[model samples]
Target: MQQKPLTGRLILADVARGLALLTMAIYHFSWDLSWFGVVDWDVSGSPGWRLFAQLIAGSFLFLVGFSLVLAHKSGIRWESFWRREIKVAVAALAVSVATYFIFQDQWVRFGILHSIVVSSLLALPFLRVHYVFALLCGAGVILLYHWLGDYVLPYRQFFWLGLNSLPEVSVDYVPLIPWFGPVLLGIGCGDILHRYDLLRLLRGSASPSVISRCFAWFGRHSLATYLLHQPILFGVVWAGVTAGVLSTNAGDVQVRSFQQSCVMACSQTVDAGVCEQACRCTSSEMMNRGVWEDLLTRPNDADVREIAQQVFQVCLRR
Candidate 1:
């Protein structure tokens, strides 16, 4: 039998989501700056940036589990559950299609939204299960992935599982593996909260400050914000660059860095002069092919890798 949807929103949860959105924006903005050469480091590839991104993604996924428990605490609301699932699935598809067109080489095939949809579906049975069971399952999943993640799958089709040794070159690539761990943990945590009647207490809590209310508003509309924020941010940055309000030397910087790194690595086996000449030749060829940025930012991209290999061969012969 279908159950009625749960009423009363959790302001604290909304506030948490709102804060996450704010941090996500900051990270994305930094990435945009890195893309525009306003930042000296590779925001997408740097260790600190990568960790920050993971934490943000983890927070969102954790909240997904928590919210699911809160929504279906009494009984499974099949109608509302399916409604939200369908909407999320559609949004995930949109993201995949849009990214495929925009970034053909480094598209997000299964990003955070896609993971959320799958995780939510997989989490259905766990909703009514004991919180400890959910917690153990979550930890098991995480441990399994940690131990076996290095083993490559036989088929490329299963890359979305995050078990393959293939290089990940997407704008966003949140897979099910350990990511589902956070969601399950969230379910366990939410169940604990429900057991202690903390959810009731939270629901009754008021947003005392203006900042809190603003954050709650953002949290409530997070899905809309997520979908719209990147495009708006990218467009604003693009417009500024086009209008000369922002200047960029990212290409030059990338080229110089690539050349220097290449020379340094090559000098280990060859003479310094030969390494310098070869690096220069490779750099020029990369620029001529309009792949200099791709070579640096997406070195593992198929076309970029192929072009680099060919260029290296020619440079070696020269």
Candidate 2:
């Protein structure tokens, strides 16, 4: 069988990657805003937001699988493959090290880049196998992880496998089980596209629009962009806060946090109206007593526990 030399680039793949990159940037920026207290809503904890994040991550993984198949379809491009892997491995290490300094408690131990490098290697053997087999394996792994959750693993090291419970503070964690599913699926998709000569079709009809070109450029240099975007955003936000351009009203932030937490806990037991009233009472008392600053800044469980006892008694009596 004659193999096609990698002469043409796939616009569709690049565009898809560009879209994922944009989505990730938007999500991360919003998360940064929430962290700075500019946004009262919890981007991380909300169900819809969480799903959006997962979809973005899954899309990127799928693209990784797709790119791998397209690159190695003719034969194993060992030199290029190793070069890309090394680049990704180094980037992953950089992320791990950088995040350790920024967020010492919840550093990215095995983030998206780490998962991709590992999964790429794992998926290599499956490239030569049938696409349907790859698809099935992907599905099975996803399902297996879902089932694995019912059982507990003893070791903390096994957390990267996605079977163990996640750590208390994980900013970005992409485990092997379900995350590998998208990569395998991408491989299958790549195989199907290759078999059908869809790459040629896509390349031939590729758009020459300015927007398309810009996105493609972003896709091409996604690694560099990914590495730099967060630092840039952090600097901008930090600078704004320092310059007093961004609002850092500690009282307002603390009040919202207190209300959100109080209402959430109270609503589980009482009515929404009751919860609202209780939260309002607690908020006012905390603010009046000058304990709000301490709770907001240097909150310990003991302090919270004592405050909760006082608030519960005071609010319940009213």
**Clash totals, every prediction:** 0, 0
Worst 10 residues of 2 by lDDT: 161-170
> What TM-score goes with each of the models?
0.79, 0.81
lDDT by residue for model 1 over 1-318, one digit each (tens)?
A: 333444678788888899999999988887776676755665754568889999999999999999899888788889999999998899999999999898675678889999999999999899888899999998988898888845557454776778765535568889888899999999999888877666765553454588888988899998889898888888888888788898889665576567656765675556545666788789898888888878777977998888887897699789
- Quantify all predictions' global Cα lDDT against the true fold: 0.81, 0.79
Candidate no. 1 TM-score? 0.79
What overall lDDT, based on C-alpha atoms, would model 2 receive against the true structure? 0.79
Over 4 Å off in model 2, which ranges? 1-6, 166-168, 204-207, 251-318
